[model samples]
Target: MKESGLPDRYENDAAEKLSPEKQLSPEQQDLKNAIKAFCIAHQHDEHAVFLIEGDAGTGKSIVINSIFNEIQSLSRSSDKSSPFWKTDNYLVVNHPEMMKLYKNISESYPALKKKDFERPTTFINRMHKSGKKADIIFVDEAHLLLTKSDKYNHFKQGNHLEELIKLARITVLVFDEKQVLKFKSCWSQGLLKSLVRGLPCQTYHLKTQFRVHAHQDVLDWIEGFCQKKILPMPQKQTFDLRFFADAQDLYDAIKKENARYRLSRMIATYDYPYRLDGEDHFIREGRFTLRWDRSKPDEKLPWAERPDTIDEVGSVYTVQGFDLNYVGLILGPSVLYDPVTDGIRIDTSRYEDGAAFTGRDGLQDPEGTKERIMLNAINVLMTRAVHGLFIYASDPALRKRLVQMQASRDAA
Candidate 1:
């Protein structure tokens, strides 16, 4: 993996991997070809949407990136017979950090330009104001697209997916319902399908696991935990899954892993207080106190790539959609163990990230939705580790239960 927490296949120097037929798994290659065929067959269609659905680490980004690279290459080719010749195309991602990584990768290839990447809001407003439409548009992290009008983001159109489909002849996007992190950008499979109901649309589901090398049992354990089922930790000798009682010990272990593996870093849930006010904010858990990641206005590298960030704790906003060799996850106070019910409980009142719950007033079962969002945040943080996963929970009962689960697995 690259220092930026991206897989080496996506490194700027790995330009050859961007080719459609190179370095892609069979599943990824098939999806890329399918998307390519869809775009060509529907080039003149009024509106077409191709939805790629996959869990985190299923190589959705790889497929989309390769397909976009091929599109750009063919569009700029001298062959006039090529259907993609001189086609106006762009790639937009809702996350700023992921956008930086995409722009960085674009610099290494001649066919791609840094400007080809944009935020969904920027691309939407720009196209609206300029009265220009793209031939094909690729959206990464489409799950982050705003489902409702977010004035804070300067997006008044309400639904970004709907607008993107209108502004492009064919819109290809990757979505994961599990990764939807906030109420403002909340999305569901049914809602996504409803948006493209009248349009020409096709869906593809990727089942391969390209990111996490852990066993199927380990993945199942994580899924069960995220779904509120506290299952026993699986025994996996190849993939390290450790539970730490002390937050400081978890941080130390993560640092050692980073020394051995360049891409390892520590991340936490949004249970700590933080803001982008150009000041330092810290996640205080007993003796383990580390500052939350800050927004670097002039930094070109992603949060995990920067050398100094090793000393900080990353939130979902910084590490989502990225890879890390080893991840030390700090589950904050919002996550608790309800012994009475013998299940996991999410204490929504303890969550410090109020922004996540903002604009959730009209939503059905607002409290339940908020709880699910919190769980999703934990799911994203937990899945970031490619090689190993180390966890520290702030709630004593929850941490004790996790320790017991690990102990039982070790005994077996």
Candidate 2:
């Protein structure tokens, strides 16, 4: 029973996790106020879909949580017979780490957590079985929601995205298209329109970044870097960007910094093979030998956020949808900077996301599909740092290309 992936002790620990209050930026507050009004106004509507879109550090989570808490407060204040009071709502996420975070948080807030948090696949399957649907659903990290039916979710009839939105009268999604890490996940204007072809829909965007401080230059640099846009040569002064020739040195620096200040992490590309098992396995690169985090024996905080997990490296799954004080990133073999083309080239064969390569859903473009997935993964890893980011490129030529591109004095 313990091997089923959901164990009794896990549930017990999940019930004890804490969620603190978040101070919202003016933009996050406005968005939350607007969405709260909309939800309350149409509390009885059986078919409304609203999209709240933003890139990383844009306070999407704060807005979502604020709106949810406000709604829950209003609901409890009203009499039970009121439509707003009796309506059931949920906050669904696709990432397991985030789901665990919210579920543990919900443990503290019973008024909100009462059947209120879940993964999309699990929520959809339960709704199908019980013939029940939510009045409203808040989907964070909607881009990570899967479409392809995996081994565990093969019983579902169609796309989980479609099934999810349809199960709610109003589905509010916080999304970023570029954050789609796997080939099966998608969140786009086209997808929303197709899912609800005839229904009128509303949209919102959060432009102000609330995560990383002094984040615009870092974001701009990332945009230009990923798009292959040759902007003015980058300066290391802004947000502490540095590229290193050695992976070990970069990791050691991150560790030293972490000792002074916690919450720093080492994250890397999925160019190396990874599995959740093997408690003893370690990734050996350069002088640094690091292990991927083993599965959580219980439902608690994520490996990336835990102090004890300092030695274990994080991949796309553990680090996405979260921020760190500093990040030491290793760009692996699958993504390489091309000297001939003067741009980056994604080698699909070198990537290790096996699900993307399989023709599981019978729609496989091979190179194009895997290339997009790999690029998206890198894009996510690059943006997770709040104050500092150091990088080491495994491919020497790519490392040299990066050095020449920014060629910061820090490196010199």
Candidate 3:
């Protein structure tokens, strides 16, 4: 029997080649220069720590790639005598899809290879044993750093970030608190203070968004909606942001959009149990049905870059570090609105990400961790679309509530 995998999806690509937005905004450029300078100045010192705090679409990948190319080019141009030429830099990403994508294009980047791109713990373990400290380590999706050993990792631990700080002469980390999907991530600003410990450290925020061409109004709605902040949904925007009354309508629209424009796909919350009985349709409601693409551990093709994945709905693990043109989001039964509280309350028992939750070294509040993961998972899917977003709720009350929220402004 072919085994099934996890259910979920997310927005932001960890690999630069898969990133749609290549051009860097001014803020991203400035951050790149700052990052370059920090690395250059600390070529021989192991006390440099820089944190880049940016939400999704702040051109973090673009900036990191630019600096990498610049450094590699400078190294190549230097006549082999310059210390700049000897600097060894590694660009690491914590997401699996991102790592897989990077390996496919690693040959083009002479400075980095499929081997250099790795999870935080593996990178930490390998570097610790290398004897020679690396000149620089660039961590993308830094918030996904794992703090414990599980089935995937058997490495001895302290913390992933602390190892990078100790072993690398210079470290560049880009993180957003919202992107902390799994568990045991110390990527927060407060954690940075304790980790750096008086080292010459600095933090930079990337404010210019280069993803999601949809208006800020749509983005604002996504934020408030996920947090259950009781805000009205977007009425009008540069791109489509609408709720479909029926799942069938949204599914039809998604198929039409895929036929017209390539790369459109549906991503859903972990509401349904994995249909492992060799069924083609993983999700079915009345006339609406779809199959989520299960992760093939050996598959090298990244879902976002592959054109054949249109028939397969993506999971949070596969799409977390990527983007899509138009997204059809299914807010699963795990999340719903309570009329009494008039706010969102996640049914923790219904959520499916508990298997991935690591807790505070296996000593955390399981219920709380599950809720956080569920919210982050849906938030990732809701924000995946660059041009448009269509949403369908699994819970009837929540579906009606979203429609009411969208039409509330009209009532006013």
Candidate 4:
């Protein structure tokens, strides 16, 4: 496999690429500067929102971190004329794993403290109880913010973004509609626009794919598959895309890659049984059997970064918003191939993540909504690979179709 042209640290942890000291592409730098100007212009405005829209692997997190670091620096500066002087700001993420990364990244910058990083619920409740307002608030993975009340997380309010806007002078967030995985956090472009309808808002889209080394056709193939269309595999070879007939072979390939590249690991759809309770849940395929990711009370690293995680299978919850140098994806029982329609099908009945479907009471179409969430989970898992993507399907028909597609591509 060819090198991804990224530093080793970035390959090991996706959050490392979001460091303020890292270099950004020309387009990313320009977006950062524009956002800074927007924040400065609206520093005292009644309400303002800047939405940074992009797909996975578009370097949205890097831009958000860079802009937040500059905001912190200017706020602490002694210059009296600076608009950010003596201002208060915070960075929030809805995902716990991603929050862990942001907090770890804070140790490298003197201007950014671990206190400055918080989960959305914690930040919202803090501001609400204290009646304290922030000057600028940066949100990463805004799509994961709760759209409905999730009492388990202690977010009584229905909309997190709305409450966040009320607590800040200016709110900047990165959103990808495809990454919205659950009914509670369900988001659409229309819903997002509705929230900031009356506020002074600006939207910017980052089109370039910065994390994945694959060509455009390869990405299109992945997107088409997620949309239930199995298009012909692309013939170009800039990135590695492979299909394995057996689960053991896929695991062996991933192990070889992990030994050579250091960040390769296997991840599966939430079709298999798994829960947060203290018990071992295993995914057994043929001769291959491995346990699902376990919570380690004393472990400081995220699931993907933990040294022992290579021996386990990760789910969307643990790997979303992160990158892997090479990812071995297991398309579990819920994902099926429909021979009649010559398309993909999502069997929601086999999906084991019941929490994802909780609170679907008012949904206009519960079944359709569930299907979309399942597809979104598959999309997030497929797009995580930085250099290569290896796939294995548990459904026999799907596995056969994928193998035939690969064979045809090779023959061409």
For each candidate, give its TM-score against the true structure.
0.95, 0.88, 0.88, 0.96
Of the two candidates 1 and 4, the one with more favorable TM-score, higher being better, is: 4
lDDT of 1: 0.86
Residues 246-355 of candidate 2: C-alpha lDDT, one tens digit per residue: 88898888987677666788888887777755545566677878887667748478666688777887888888877776789988887777767677777878887675
Which residue pairs come into collision in candidate 2? none
lDDT values of the candidates?
Answer: 0.86, 0.71, 0.71, 0.88
Q: Which pairs clash (backbone N, Cα, C closer than 3 Å) in model 1? A: none
Q: Candidate 4 on 5-109: residue-level lDDT in tens? A: 545443546556768878998989989988998997888798899999988988999999988998898888888788888899999998878888888888888
Residue 323 lDDT in candidate 1: 79
List ranges where model 4 is wrong by over 4 Å.
1-12
Q: Write the per-residue lDDT of candidate 1 for residues 286-399, one digit (tens) a residue.
A: 999999998885688888787788999999999888878789999998889989866789989999888888888568888888888998898899888777899999999989
Give me the candidate number with maximum lDDT: 4
Q: TM-score of the candidate numbered 4?
A: 0.96
Q: What is the lDDT of residue 141 in candidate 2?
A: 89
> After superposing candidate 2, which stretches have Cα over 4 Å from the reference?
1-20, 78-83, 228-233, 359-364, 404-412
